[model samples]
Target: MKFDTIIIGGGLSGMTCAAMLAKNGQKVALVTAGQSCLHFNSGSIELLGFQEGKVVERPFEGIAQLNEAHPYRKIKTEKLAVYAEEARTLLAEAGLKMKGNAEKNHFRLSPIGTTIPAWLTLEDLITLETTAELNGKKLLLANVEGFLDWPTAYLSDSLSAMGANVKTASFTTEALAFARKSPTEMRAINIAKYLDKAQNIADAAREINRLGKGFDLVLLPAVLGLAHDNVDLLRKAVETPVECVATMPPSVSGIRIENKLRGFLGQHGAVVLNSDTVNNGFFEGDKLTAITTEKLEETRLEANQYVLGTGSFLSGGLVSDYQTITEPALHLEVEAHESRTQWTSEYLFDEQPYMAFGVKTTDDFHPMKDGKAVTNLYAIGSVLSGNSGIKQATGTGVSMLTAIAVAHNILNQ
Candidate 1:
């Protein structure tokens, strides 16, 4: 089938945009690596641009001015503000909600609170068991041995303050019977995914229920029950109203968000082609024509415009390996010091301002390849002009807003 547009990469940016475009009644196709950087993200809408430093009183307004300053800075501030508004609306329509101000408000986040607002409490068994399809559930708190995670004592305190009734039991591969197989592993990261597969919620619940007599619900890590090959069984387990709460990185809220977004898109007739196609990019003159896939072979992606939201180095959104820090799409110059060796420090929280790298975009963010638009593709998020502290605060919101602006601009075109 012919599509109106083709998107590359399936991280948060790509999938979120796919949901928005499909909802807008456009024929969109997403080409992605399926489950890319989403695994390592914080899932919180970030904008750390000014939390601990210089604050752009009118953040979006500053983005417009950046176009003149750098190739990566080519976004219109007004458009970004509008995009943020729409992104919030869509997120709520999709089941999650972010409350508060763009500059002062926090979004709903999990695994780490305060960093992101709008987080629903997974600790509240009453809320999870009652509001969610789960009740009388047993939640598993799986943590990696010796890994520093957000304080559990602090989290439990917050949960109690919120009137939640939940208990946490932590075990390393050392304690569980599985420890014999592997010394260090997450139960949810490994085991739950398998059980959620080999046995349906009912069967496994029955089997495990037999082993440990208690609540009928089993709440575990976000990656739990779905990391392995056969995952449909885990889906079957949700039959008994089993639910998984969101967790920190390596298992950010990406999967949960993706699963929910896919449902929303499907209901609206949007077809999300998983990463099964051997796809290749086709450039026609100054524009991307159609994408060629192994299955479809060749097709037309005759859209008015495109949005690029692939993230930075860690997320594979941009290239930050060695002496370079540029997006292959625009080839904008990355702001680097004398040596790539100084890219980062071993201590992640050392606050070396130089380590947070990014592209310096043109006012319109088309990327200046020899002082011209690099194929009319607009770059956003970690791929474009950004500072780690600032970006850490607003990364998710930044991607959504910019993509929305790109879509709107395309509509006008």
Candidate 2:
């Protein structure tokens, strides 16, 4: 079957591109072999240097500064700017909006706070992005009552800039409070306590609605509604529309982004496929046209465009354990070592996730062979290698941006 676009992975990055293309009225099919990594960590659509809707220079120069294993030591600054623009465009097209502007890095301390990295939020855009009713129209932010490390009034300031007069409500479920409670039972004191005080379904509804009075959104650390592998549950529990902003709790926001995107994409007609198994791929003069796997028994499909979003170590695109990337459809050249043993080691310095594995590409994120674009394919996300400097980096955001850039290349072509 012929398609306007064929995306191979089902991860956030891939799905982000597929969602945009499909939403814009493209015939797109997303393929994945199994589960995704989005649910594995906290969900933060972060940026290294983000503030007021712009992409600015980050203090950190390169990925090598963050970890020793970074494959390529540096990426040009101009390249990062292009990528930032691409990310913002992609999200905006798909209904997940963000700014492509420049600013400074803002990392939040935890239990739900905000960091104003260099990217910008709409000063007046925070009114109500969702359909759910907030505490009467004003946003209610709940965090540890006295948390010093947290980025306080961060998002609120941005929202206020947007004319969203919000109120802050400190609560006991702060990280410190939760830590004091028993590991298992602490949950009772936390999310459970929040629910119990409301007491009963009707009461819970009343409490959440009361809290939301004058607020159109509820900004909380990703903790409250992050259980049960679903973000929707929190909305159900709170009886109000919620935006589980973001926090540093091991990527809860990231996982939620993945879950929500997967379901949304499926409902919009994108096929998800993933697998550890390598399928035989065929190409003609460096252009991949077909692939063969056990499931399809050598079936092939044609496509007008390709967006490669195989992410970095976190996305499982490249690995030291596997020793080889197991070339997908293209027999593209990789920077593998002469001796597979030379590929990696147990040493932390040597085994840094940044280094050891990657698909070489140009600033445009298109794989290159002798300085020429490889077909109509656009490579994106962690697969490109480099550019993941610690200070001004957010993987999911990077993925979103890169996917946008790639889609821009594809659709415009």
Candidate 3:
């Protein structure tokens, strides 16, 4: 098999890069190993939420202050602004409706009800320029009866503290009740599956409408829109204005984004190999010639260029043994500490060194092998070492901007 470009890992970065290239008429192929971190998203894309222990009001300004090794530094601050808009446009083209921009960061209500800085928030979620916006408003917090993931109490308390007239309600349909029979399967995704039907959506809407009378806004757990935008249907059914708060994974909103983007890739003629893993890379001299997957053993999949967006340790992009950490796919050079003891911090909340550990890359985002840059292989997203997405709150931004930058590099070349 051959393609213009082959991207390993179909997470945010890989998908973004594939989508951009495919849209521009490049024959692209993407291989993904099941689930992505999008399952844990909060319905928002954060660009540098916190910098130097402070919330960043403007993402570009905060990105400018990032360290030399941070992925954002590779593109430089000025180009990031251009790519930021392009990323947003690409996502919009993929059917994601979002609010906010790269220049200014808005605040999205977290699962626990605290506000977090975000570059773009899904349209169905609540975003505020300031906490004062929540003051003096009538709000209703609604959740599924058996769903334990939604923190009703925390959300109510946080909203009330912001001076909002808060009320809580629980509503469930027959399908939702049926799903609750199995405790282990009673997750957000399961609830969303049951609630996706027409009758279930209408039943839930009726209950919410009854409880949401005279309320300024009705907030429900983000359990709608997994396979489709059922939230829109629910909103149309209920008379009151309705919105969703992000719930614990598997995030319905994130999954929706992934599905939309993946669908877009297919629509644009891109081959997507889901639930497949890249097991080996065939390299010659300083270039990666082809790769093989677990499913397609011995059948070499060749491409002119390759993208490694396999993600960090959590996603199995990079692995750590007793002696050292290494990039598993191609044995690419990684940036990490030698001693295992130095990989972590004493405090759980403190900065951990391992999170910043990933494949070392050049200014153009090419992965290195034996201290030499791989001519046709580029690493993007969390796979590149330097900044910790968890600590810096730049995960989504890095995944997106780096992917866009790499796509441009491939297209121009």
Candidate 4:
């Protein structure tokens, strides 16, 4: 099939780019072998959580000091500012409203009651300046009947030690009848789906009213809703403010955002083909003309522009073997140490050198081969080298920013 742009990998980066490009009037197709990492995320967009072993208060300031080779540096400061604002607007319009901004990072409580700095968090999350803020607040945690992803009692105890009036209340089996009716024990996603229905949410809200009386705020597990914004519905039903704490994956929050993006892009006419991996690229001189997929080897997907966002080793953009590491698709040049021993630090908690390994690219995000740029083909997200998304807590940020940059570059062309 012919198109203006073909994005390999339907992960966050690829989908973000696809949506932007399609909105800008480019015909886009996104291909992926499996589900995106969004399903495994904590629903928070973390940007530069740590700097030189120190916690960062402001991520925008942190980006200024990033090494020249880091991916964020490629987009330039002015463009990054525009991209950040645009990304926030797009996400909010897609129905996954987020809080926080570029001025500073906000702290959100984790499942263990510890706070972590995040650039953008869902509006349903209770953000705090410090653990001390929880002190004296009448906080009630609503634990689902069989959800074991987080220990409510332990978290409540931890909060209590910090001077907060924390208490735990369980949603009895009858209250969670919607979840208990499932063939298997309810997971985060299942609970979220059940809560998506207005009737089920109203019923649960009534139950919360009975069990969560006199609390300043009711805290529920992240399974607030999946199909729609149930946070508002549930909040209105109970006539009290509600917040969701982070839980283990399949993250309901992440799925909600992913589904919203998918629906938004679908409405804009972008074709998303999952379970299809790009196997090889056909190049004419320095520009890629077409790509072949694993499922459809005989068919070539032709496009004027291509984006390689297959992600790092975790997503199979770069492959590591006993002898060497390689970028299998198009055999793009990978940036890494010559030996495996140098890939990691001696200390486990210290920065791992291997985390920064991926395809080396130019400022324009075109993959580099033997010190020359590969024309017409752009690389973004975890696939780009010179920065550690995991170490810096910049995975989603890097992916979204780079995707926006790539889309703008393509549009400008």
lDDT of 4 by residue, 229-288 (tens): 788888888966788888877788788778888888898899888799988888767888
| True-structure RMSD, every candidate | 8.0, 9.6, 1.5, 1.8
What TM-score would candidate 2 get against the native? 0.59
lDDT of 1 by residue, 315-399 (tens): 5556655665655543455656658667667776655645356665555555444445655565666565554533334555556
Number of clashing pairs, model 1? 37
Give the local distance difference test score of model 1.
Answer: 0.50
Clashing pairs in 3: none
lDDT for position 166 in model 1: 49
Write down the TM-score for model 1.
0.63
Better structure of 3 and 4 per TM-score: 3
Q: Name the candidate, 1 or 2, with the larger TM-score value.
A: 1
Off by over 4 Å in 1: 41-43, 48-50, 53-81, 97-103, 107-186, 189-246, 276-285, 290-303, 328-338, 345-347, 350-356, 389-391
Off by over 4 Å in 2: 49-101, 110-221, 226-252, 263-268, 274-278, 321-331, 336-356, 368-373, 389-394
Candidate number with the higher lDDT (2 or 4): 4
For each candidate, what TM-score against the reference?
0.63, 0.59, 0.96, 0.95
Q: Model 4 off-target regions past 4 Å?
A: 173-175, 181-183
lDDT of each: 0.50, 0.52, 0.90, 0.85
